[model samples]
Target: MAQGSGGNVIAAICNLFFPGLGQLVQGRIIAALIFAIIVVGGYALWWLVIPAIIAGVFHLWSIIDAARFKASD
Candidate 1:
């Protein structure tokens, strides 16, 4: 909402639609793909269930990470 607000805020918001989307928004290509595999793959294998739940956790982590991401880190 401020002039200096970083891309992380935007990225985190983007993550709401899907996991790894934030990373993609932040230009974290590898992270995006990796997360996409983890989360998307988890959803694909819905029968397994456990991994999918874990992926949900990962998605939450992604949101937090994106919110805190900095160019330096």
Candidate 2:
């Protein structure tokens, strides 16, 4: 397994801009899609400004977690 620490770091940075961005960076299409929907839905429900922010934080966390992925040889 390749070391994806860099990708994860990048994803975390992107999460600050938008939720689900980290997942996209990590190649987690499904997770990214789900998070995207949640982000969108949050916005739909009264602009979801606060929830969006929270999601952004969580997204970053996910990215960090992905970065910790150690490849097993």
Candidate 3:
């Protein structure tokens, strides 16, 4: 709740809304895009409950990692 937070919470929220967003915010574009593609592609191709669950778990992990990350000052 102060200045110089470096978008940690923002990254977490992004990751929560969409998996891989945290990595994107961390500047890991390739990793983020790849995961995003996997999630979307899996949904379109499989349309199974397992894929959705996995994606949700991954999203939650990304968000947690983002939230725990130490922002640059």
Candidate 4:
């Protein structure tokens, strides 16, 4: 999908609910896995505060990344 397409919009929305879910929808398996692992791992360690903050940053990054993804021609 091209950047700024309807698919990207959908992907961004999916990421809003769960980071990396949008990447999964976009067929970016590696990116999806990385985002999911990092974000989820940080969330799992939320008691540490810093990890939770990092996870939050990654969550937003995932959403923006999904929204801006442009498939290779």
Candidate 4 regions with alpha-carbon error over 4 angstroms: none
- lDDT (10s digit) by residue, model 3, range 1-73: 2222557778778886787887788777886887687676655645687887776666566677666766355
The candidates, ranked best first by TM-score, are 4, 1, 3, 2
Cα RMSDs of all predictions? 3.2, 3.6, 3.9, 0.6
lDDT of each: 0.80, 0.65, 0.70, 0.97
lDDT of 2 by residue, 1-73 (tens): 2556666667767766776777677777887787777665655554647886766555556556555645455
Rank list by lDDT: 4, 1, 3, 2
RMSD of 3: 3.9
lDDT string for model 1 (11-67, tens) is 888887888898898788999888878888887877898988988888888888778
CA shift at 45, candidate 4, in angstroms?
0.7
> For model 3, what is the error of residue 42's alpha carbon versus the real structure, in angstroms, after optimal superposition?
4.0
Count clashes in each candidate, considering only residues at least 3 apart in sequence or on different chains: 0, 0, 0, 0
Model 2, residue 29: what's the lDDT? 84
Runs with alpha carbons beyond 4 Å of true place in candidate 3: 1-6, 70-73
TM-scores, each model vs. reference: 0.82, 0.58, 0.63, 0.97
Candidate 4: what lDDT? Answer: 0.97
